[model samples]
Target chain A: EAGVAQSPRYKIIEKRQSVAFWCNPISGHATLYWYQQILGQGPKLLIQFQNNGVVDDSQLPKDRFSAERLKGVDSTLKIQPAKLEDSAVYLCASSSQGMTEAFFGQGTRLTVV
Target chain B: DQQVKQNSPSLSVQEGRISILNCDYTNSMFDYFLWYKKYPAEGPTFLISISSIKDKNEDGRFTVFLNKSAKHLSLHIVPSQPGDSAVYFCAAIWSNDYKLSFGAGTTVTVRA
Candidate 1:
């Protein structure tokens, strides 16, 4: 079975510029998640979607970051006015159910200069 | 506040030796625990998991042990291989919530 897929394995953007990352989860998985991993740290949950409906996004930065899972299959995460602190690897993962083990994608490494 | 903690940032062990990585969590509500392995430039992959009801779970050469009373859990790799050298993260989830809280991650180097 194919694993989760993401686009633009690497991205470089200037501070204050806008950037977007895409994710396509595994087939038949209903739960999707977005996470940010800064250097030397573990992935921090940014948002979660269960079939196009948000399950949790308490950690998301509403002032600069937003994400959506249209039709519940593919999802996109966007950051506007990016800052140097936003430089990190954005990882996408999916699971068959909310409580099950998740499979992850290669991730999009965003470098904000 | 960082709820999950992996105090050891890195560890080095010889191949064929046992590698033990430790994690501690402060949240009492966390009922499920998991371990994930990540390679450079790659996302973390699930390695093993244990539920609150159980103390241990094993898969191949990897074993996860949970000590609920101590709010600590550990991942043990026996006869470590060079391929096993990577960052390992420990995560915990509440019983009613699917959101996982993760540790800072521990990098393990299996020297040949």
Candidate 2:
């Protein structure tokens, strides 16, 4: 079976610029998630979507970050006016309902200069 | 506040020896705990998990032990191999929520 897929394995943007990342979840998966992994840190959940409806987004920066999952299959995460601190790897994961384990994508490493 | 913490930033052990990584959580509501292993430039892969109702879970060479009363958990890898060197992260989730909260990862190095 194919795993979760993400595009633009690497991205570099200047401060104040905007960047977007995309994710395609595994087939038949009902839950999708976006996570950020800063250097030397574990992945932190930025948002979660349960079938195109957001389940949680408490950690996302509302002023600069936004995400959407259309049709519950693909999702996108955007950051506007990117800051140096925004440099990190953006990971996407998916899991089936009532499943405890999640499958992750390779992630897009974003570098904000 | 950080709900999960891996106090050890790095650990080294000889090949064929046991490697133990520790993690602690501050939230009692967390009922499911997991361990993920990650290599450089790759996403974390789920290793093992234990529920609050159980104290230990074992899978092949990997084992996870949970101390619910102390809010602590640990992962043990026996007969560690060179390929086992990677960053290990501990994560937890509340029973009602599917989202996971992760700790800072611990880098493990196995020497031959």
lDDT of 2 at A98: 80
Candidate 1 C-alpha lDDT tens digits along B1-112? 7999999999999999999999999999998999999999898999999998999999999999999999999999998999999999999888576778889999999999
Compute the DockQ of candidate 2: 0.81
TM-scores for chain B, listed for all candidates? 0.98, 0.98
The DockQ-based CAPRI class assigned to model 2 is high
Highest DockQ among the candidates is held by which one?
A: 2
Off by over 4 Å in 1: none
- How many Å off is the CA of A86 in candidate 1? 0.5
Candidate 2 — which pairs collide?
none
Query: Using Cα atoms with residue i matched to residue i, what is each candidate's TM-score against the true structure?
Result: 0.97, 0.98
Question: TM-score (chain B) for model 1?
Answer: 0.98
